[model samples]
Target: MEGPIEIRGLTKVYGGGFKAVDDLNFVVPKNAFMGFLGPNGAGKTTSIKIITNMLSATSGEAIINGINVMSDPKMALADVGAVVETPEFYPYLTPMETLLYLGSLRGMTNTEITNRGRDLLDMVKLTEWKDQRVGKFSKGMKQRLAIAQALLPQPSVIILDEPTSGLDPRGMVEVRDILKELRKIDVSVLMSSHLLNEVQEVCTDVTLINRGKMLRSGSVASLLNEVKAHKIEVRVLSPPALEVTNQLRSFPGVKEINYMSDVVFNVDFEGAEAEQAGLLLQLQGMGLKVVSFKESGLALESLYMSLIMESR
Candidate 1:
């Protein structure tokens, strides 16, 4: 099936012959929340620029909803909403006023603007500050407002560039929460980010890239399944006895164990979800009060790092 967003042979070269994007190809499946990931200088931003029509591609096609972006930018991008890099807004305008102005530019009626603007502000948890000047708002608030503006037109596809890049922990959580809410909507999202945990938490699929080249791309579960083993952290209510540790070490799928302390240890576990559940049961059956049993390393992070290393 044709996706909402597709890149075929996309490439970008600067005057210095620096290849920012190199023959990239991928698709943002309909209704899929996909993360575009890579390290610094990995061409993620450049590819997004091309797809959003902010920059022209040297050689390739950026097709949005099946329309060629370079051939008909206005039409291709008509159904798309984008937030690129740090979103900047007029410092003097209130959130409502900013939305109204941008909505007008999109040719929305006053009534449509007011209703949609109010709804979006509420969705992003900015309804209380809807009338406040943007200058007084924190970076997190501004980012939320930016999202409201992007969604003002009710576009079908949303593109975000590191939506949580510069926020503090609280701010990052806020933005991530908004993204989770976004999942409830029917829009297809293609977000570019380097944060592994963020993607693992919110994105259903991921596309990995490096030095302007495609590394791997697929649904999160499929990619994670490629990981042969996971490092799990197991914490018990009390320090485990030697015999308890011995039993744990002998458990099936437990490849290796590294004790962090008497109460906590890391297990190199080669198992599926069912096996993991069994391991937890086994720990409980041993009369140990398990406090936590969770994967210490993100499966996506492991896969992403390994692919990047191989590419280098």
Candidate 2:
């Protein structure tokens, strides 16, 4: 199978010397559900805009299914669909009417339009509201309608920006399931979201960025395991006295120490449990209140923070 998306050194610069993207590179294998993650203003929307041929990039290249997006936008977009930040619709139009309207733009026949609309509304669990005016619908309802329209073209690639926005927990799960169902039919997905938990629940591979620079990009499992350097948090009862941290700081493999709250301290180690034990003993010897200790799992929030801090 051909690669669904290929990007290399994708960069975008605006007026006033502002750069929205900088040397960003990634790929979404054909039929793969790839997550695009980043904090606000991390150039995600800008990158997406360039990919869809909505905006021209200042440099670099991207191809979808063997067609360069910049070289032949029509052919490149023939099999691609996207739902940018906020999906729009005709206020007075029904869900079915909205989808059929979009289908007309794609040159779908009336029969094809009606058939596809019914099938998609059913797929999105909005069959019951197909004839209802979209203006009266809730956010989730509107999103479902937008999805129906987005799929009317039968595109191979579906790029969604913040699919879970305006959705409650159950609605979010529904959208996630919709994406999963798309994967089963070999649809390539490129989704962008800052909701780490949602991405963790749905995406297989990811590219995370901050300040317009790629922080980490790969399988979620590998990225989570990237910080293998062991880190632990400890709580003490008799809090260490002044200058007491200096003694433990001299121990081998102790990278750094941080006091979180008055009684808790975080220790960075180089995977030496023996050295950690020795250090703990030294702290205990100081007659400090040794309360509890636990391993700290690397969280997405922490990973994001580390990326932002490293950028600074």
Candidate 3:
């Protein structure tokens, strides 16, 4: 019943009065896929370093599940798996051997290591390459292996920093697919990323930060729904005529319309729920077969850009 992560005034400062993280506070609930969002130099990496004990906080406390990381790091991190950045592997070692070594370091017995390692390799879709040298694997493959290693202990909370930072389109897709699977297993995850689309696709909740400060935090759906005005994409069954396009503009509550194609258009509208419903009905009454209507704006991107500008 406990939340997986909590922070109170987590501040980090360097020698010359550079505050990397400033009075940050947030809590990630149990099994929450929380996206820690920010631009470069926004203290995301610095905060993660403090949580994993890579660096000491200038002030404040970070608690993981019920253990205070600052006071009892060993116990606090016992059930936590973190990948702060790109993890390197012994190129000569195979996936099986690599995991065996890592497991031995964690005091896992031979039987436990073998069994768990096998399962982890399978989970990361590397079962076929278990005996293959890691040196032959691509960057995406290595990243997957890193993730499997992070889950070796079956940790309750997983912390990832820029998990898909640099990779080909295919690699990025593969990693994101794996991240989506984590939610099905009920693992709490905190992934940091500056990419809005990536976070929007993979995270259910988000905490946006800028210049080492918290800007907003909430559920993705709720945040998107909170926007007062929206750019809506509408697709009709047939090519819309000039008169039909003109009719779209004259619709109540529609501020403007941009023609995207014969059958598609984007409408900027400011309206309440009831008004929107009425507008849709009016469009249908105009003899246009509506195929789809949905918000076209990327709400997270909009929010992130606005907050960053305000912080400046």
Candidate 4:
């Protein structure tokens, strides 16, 4: 059950000499749920395609466990399961039938398929729908089935691209719950998504990419800590006037303010530790009843924007 996915100096050049992935280098640790993060067209998908052997890299290497994908894709990817995008199942096939067909293609015996299929269906909470036609399933149900399909081969590492993309709120939650379950099973998952919150919630580590270049790679906590910024949530006894709100925004160290409710709001403050401490005092001095004040972790959205802007 080896799970490390290593990429060294990987590069992908298109016909017009545009490089989609430029000498990217990183490693998804064994049994780590790592997020492959980037803006659209930032080579996230291209790098993943190279790893899955769907697209050939112009140069460099992708090694899964100890085997090189470029040298021998079959052996390297034999234990890898990937859901690059939403896959369409046959309209008439039941979940059980679809899995059995897929399992047979993978050279599993009928007994193996039946036993493993049942386990996977249960894992995905699809036991009740196992015999139901896929045509009647919702987008979320289809996604759950897709995950079951990926697990049928007992892969140690699962690669998913935007697994929650295009789903409704409930569907997103369903998919996210499944990802959380994978973490409990010691299955390394490399999931690519633009949703920063999703990565923050589901991934232990992350590799950030922009314009075919690696921006940062580290544990989520470490990355957030590295951001030399502060977001503070403040609660007041009552909402302030327009002028008072404007005054806070125009403060020397305050970068932005977002109203959460009548008496609560969050502010992005860029200042030293001393300045942050003085902010609450300053608000109180302005005749506002500052009920509570605390520094919040840098939001993934803010961190991402900061990095993206800095990269640009």
Task: Compare the candidates by TM-score and give the number of the best one.
Answer: 4
Predicted structure 3: lDDT: 0.86
Each candidate: how many clashes? 0, 3, 0, 0
> Per-residue lDDT for 51 in model 4?
92
lDDT of 4: 0.88
Superposing every Cα of model 1 onto the true structure, what RMSD results? 3.8
Per-model TM-score, in order, reads: 0.83, 0.79, 0.81, 0.86
Clashing residue pairs, backbone N/CA/C < 3 A, model 3? none
Deviating ranges (above 4 Å) for candidate 4: 1-3, 233-252, 256-266, 271-275, 291-298
Give per-residue CA lDDT, model 1, range 1-312, as digits (tens). Answer: 479999999999989999999999999999999999999889999999899989999999999999999999989988888999887899999999999898887789989999999999998899999888999898888998888888889899999999998999998998999899889999999999999999999999999999999999899999998975788999999998888889889999898889998889999888788899999998899999999999887888878877898998
Clashing pairs in 1: none
Q: Deviation in angstroms for 239 in model 4?
A: 6.3
State in Å the error of residue 226, model 3: 2.1
lDDT of each: 0.91, 0.80, 0.86, 0.88
lDDT tens digits, residues 108-173, model 2?
A: 898998988889999999899888888878888777777777788888898888887879988888
Q: For candidate 4, write residues 138-243 as lDDT tens digits.
A: 8888988999998888888889988998899988998898899888986788999999889999999999999999989878888876665678999999998989
Q: Pick the candidate with the highest lDDT.
A: 1
Clashes of 4: 0
Candidate 3: RMSD to truth: 3.7
Pick out the ten consecutive residues of candidate 1 with the lowest summed lDDT.
297-306
